[model samples]
Target: MDVSARWDNACRASLFGSFSLSGPDGAHIPISSNKARALLAMLCVAPQEAMERDHVSKLLWPGRFQAQARASLRQCLLILDRALEPQNITMLEPSHTMLAIEPSIVRSDFEELIEALNDLRIQEACSLLATIGNKPLLDQMDFGDQFRAWLKIQRKHVEGQLQIAVSRALVALDRDGDMDGHAQLSEAWLACGRADARHWDGKIRIAVLPFEQRDAVGGPFFLAEGVVEELVSRLSGVSALAVVARASVASVANSGRTIPALASALNVSHLVEGSVDRFPDSIRITLRLLDGPTGVQIWSHRYDGTLEGAMKSRPHIGANIIAGLCKAIGVEAHTRAARTMTASREAYSLYLQGRALTYRAIGDGVLDKAIELLEQALELDPDFAECWTALAEAHVNTIVFTPQLDRVERSQRMADCAARAIELDSRQGHAHSMRGIHEWTLGNPLGALDHAYEAYRLEPNNADVTARLGSFLLYIGHTQAALPYVEEAIEQDPVYGRNFAMLCAAHFNLENYDAALAAGQRMIDLGMPGMWLAVIEAALGDNEKAVETYFRQRLLMNSVILPPAGLAPMDDDARDAYWTIASRGICSGMEDDRAIYCQILDGLHLAMPDPCDASIALPAIWMGHAELVMKLYRKQIHPANMLGLMSLWTDVDPIRQTRLHPSFLSFADDIGLVAAWEKYGWPDLFPRSSHID
Candidate 1:
């Protein structure tokens, strides 16, 4: 009766599809008691193969007295021991206080499945998952409420893992050109329906590659790209699907990568690719929907029409493409009808030209020209919601990128255009996004968040909207919640540099300096301002690099003068003094609010700006002047400057210190942050349970 003597090394427990333990010879070991099987499962899934005896008892035998629960657990262990003895398996190692599974003696299929997926053993993972075949964990067994709660979480976790694994396997199969295998596996996966569809979770992610212009020797090449953008916008409305951003897809469209490589790069489940061939007065468009994982063509279609006819029929074509894709993917295509932006073909063409101009408005007078074009488009069709959104966007670019322009006038125009776009079509995500930006500029952080969330709900797949939501959340100190949105936006549009900046901020606030540094480096690589990198580098105890980075940023900002010499060997206090003065110089050559900011940084006690800018509080916060921060907080800063508070949560040296101050909670409470935290979860630096202490 020595269980250790009969221990079988090949014993394996199958927790998915069915609950069974098999011996080395592939024979099922009888485990008659469901509770015993549940007990085995509890141990297998538990971290480090161990769980406290009391906790395990409560989970398995909830509602029983503590002593009775303990007794039941003991009885369950004995049943498992007896069942495994026949297979020569010493399945568990139980002490008076803890129960531990003996991995050397027996292993679970779930563990093997996870290992296979992690190691990219796609074939093996697919095979193991196919056995589960969408079946619920433990099949027909039901446990107590406490146990059920634990099971529910585990089930969700497993479902997520399996979905990713299966998706990857399909992609791998497609890459290898195994069509039959892909077909079989696809069927198996479809049979196992997914349970999570919230936001972008457990959704079909697709990227539309820029359409090829076959006769581009002199034809309208931009039209090809326009087709892709139109399709991307149309597909983004589907709740069951997430579309990759046009910028990312376009960036890689001409790289000549294989289908599988394209899918991998975009992190998508499907790809839409096509070519546009020009005729004398018409065009021939051929579109193909490929399974993202397998590169197998699920559907293909060709449309031939006159140039004018083709431009006007884009909505109908997009609908057909969406329908075909959804049908092949086994998902419902619940899409809103595309609104006609303009009745005039000329206006629609002008709108496309103007919208494209806004994307690359860094050149001299580019934004001005885009604004002119969009305005003309509106002249012909003033009710065009999309054109209004595009006009609003152009105005915002002028406000932020063109410092020479009239900021107040541009801001007003941006707000009015956004309001009009929303009035025309409340469902326009970009319109809402522009309005969100306008709200933040007006110092209404809460209103900004409301508009941002509405934009996200309207177009969850849009990289810009997703990134904006993350940015708005970060502004209000919701760093943890903001992290995933930033991450998802980066995945959808990796080439867009702003999301990486947001990513850096999120990681920095969470005190993840290494990740923050990496993200900042990426932002820099993408040609964005790397001012945040200096802060992250400083946080990681690299003051020399931090100083170098800050100086470089100031130089880029065209600072009139540099930090004083002989600063390298300066003590911490002196170095901080130099840093504060140098940081203030970042706003050099600015006017209005920015000029006020510089004055505040210089420590000249002038009348405070209408909005108590949180950014202006940075020098004091970094100097550990908690009282100053509190004073500013009490000033009831303009609601328009509320978004600027994001600067206060950068997790720099004194930020954490400031939050830890005795009066910090009172300040937070007065600013309505405590209530926000209570509703949306506390920030990383100010956990609800620990901040009070």
Candidate 2:
């Protein structure tokens, strides 16, 4: 048989990293000499597996006499032969005129990589390339100067081919509208780009810590947090600045660290800290910007103004801070801070209080209180675009984070408020982002994409906008594309639990289970709900851990139900019944749990719920209730039903197995999911049928 024909059946040799020959039985024959490895690598990259004896000798030992160089080459070949002999493999075929590897007897990873690329098996090619990550050919070997120079050229040529193959694959995937595939390829491309040191040139990084309240009397306690929030928001508008997220700064603010320490922790070059003192009619704001490394004060200012004047002066104050930083860093500011201000002092204060309350606790009627306060502010000054935006966001959060209100009603209200904000200020990124969320919830991906892209275009450096874009991508099953945005958001605000949760979802969708688990844990550590963590644990096959996580989530939900405490109202009996079913499903050796699970399914059917309620199907599938899932699929075809695309999730195993069943096929056909999967490549876990790739 020819070498190519026998390649798969023959013993393999890997020369990319180290010199080793492996037999069919998988034992390795190691070759330790640098010259021997280089010789093998030279042949590995050869146009053919053979080279003329004199030509090889001249390349390896150019300065030596022809006879001396040939002798050295012969010695290196002898060493390589001896190494392969132990594996019962005649790897080297040497003659008086030409030398080569016994093509039918040996193969290498390089050949396999080439074959994979030629066949357009990009995932396999990437897997093979990962084995050679960042390592040059013959990486640990040191040969003679002439051979070393040849090796350098060969290494570059090989890497260049690999990169070209990757780029071609990316183009093909993009042309096919395979967003996930494009994202993975983009990741590999970015890894290559990161090798260049100038990738992040001329970027200014800063973190604004929460301003402290020097005097706590008279003014609302949330004033300090509110001021820092506004400062961070205004500073985020500057084009040249990379502002650290408020969540990340808040995480380290109470650590009793100096300005330098805080800056170091946040990975920023500048730090902003200050105090607010409130009196009957005026507020005193003291601000200082400090150098991150040396803790030197770069600028300081104290502004005392009437309540209305201070509320209106925030943009000017923020602009001055940006100017000072620009002057200190020798970089010109490209944009000025612009904020929509309310003429009513009470309205501004009410808006600030509402904003602060919205951040207090999830699922606690804090968001509702925020809405009430913002409504009061709006009544005082109906044209307050900022207040409208804040209210819109709060309404959306009430739907997303709490189960108290009707989702349909809140979504409509959120849309209205967002539209009002956009009418008042066409360029408000927050309004655009809020509208994007509303559109996504309404199952309009194209509209969501337009708004998300607009939000990012308007405020590229805004961490919130970046995170929103990431979320929208994930919602549309473009998990890989969502990665960079979420990562940037985390880079900007490391302490933000929502960003971490989004990252967890992105990693989970990518089948990076370990990274998903880590991000989920980080979300839990940061005091966010861990519903996703439970799913991650379940996916990782840790039933006990998943059950424990479920219990913790249950406790978290119950803990927030303090009656008459301004928290969202909950149906205790219904919540308890739901948890009971979930807990039983996760526990082992419980036949009764299975019966109870079936009973819950029966009751859900009997209740005759809305056909559009697709969320319940996810939990049913997670609990291995395939019948319920099929029923849900038959009832509704909502875009929010991501289960069809999330084939890699362990929770979807039962669903995947049932994809060929008559009911499932009908469901898929009726919902147009099969055609959707055909448009993009079928997910890895999808069954390979005649209609699928």
Task: Name the lDDT value of residue 291 in candidate 1.
Answer: 67
Our model 2 lands, by Cα RMSD against the true structure, at 18.3
Model 2 lDDT at residue 490: 80
Q: How accurate locally, in lDDT, is each candidate? A: 0.68, 0.65
Give stretches of model 2 more than 4 Å off. 1-202, 214-226, 251-267, 279-282, 291-296, 311-315, 361-364, 560-618, 624-652, 655-693
Instruction: For residues 486-529, write the lDDT of model 1, one tens digit per residue.
Output: 88898668667778778877877787665676678767756676
Instruction: Tell me the lDDT of model 2 at 171.
Output: 43
Compared with the true structure, what per-residue lDDT tens digits does model 2 show for residues 1-693? 122455655776675776566776667657776667667766766524467888678666656788998889888988987887766666677888988776666667766765565445667666666675665666666544335545654664455445434543554465567888677656654554412222123345778877878663554545566678777776676665668876577678898877755765566667888898877667788878776645778677777876567656667766776676555544566664476767787887798888877665465478889999999999999999988988998887676555432566677788899899989987778788878766644545567668888988877777778988877666445666678888878867767787887887777778777667667767876777776777766655666656667666666654532222123344867667776666656442255765576566656555533433433555565555656666665654333343233332332443234444546545554545455345543434445573521
In model 2, the Cα lDDT at residue 681 comes to 36
Off by over 4 Å in 1: 1-165, 168-199, 214-222, 254-259, 291-298, 328-330, 551-644, 656-693
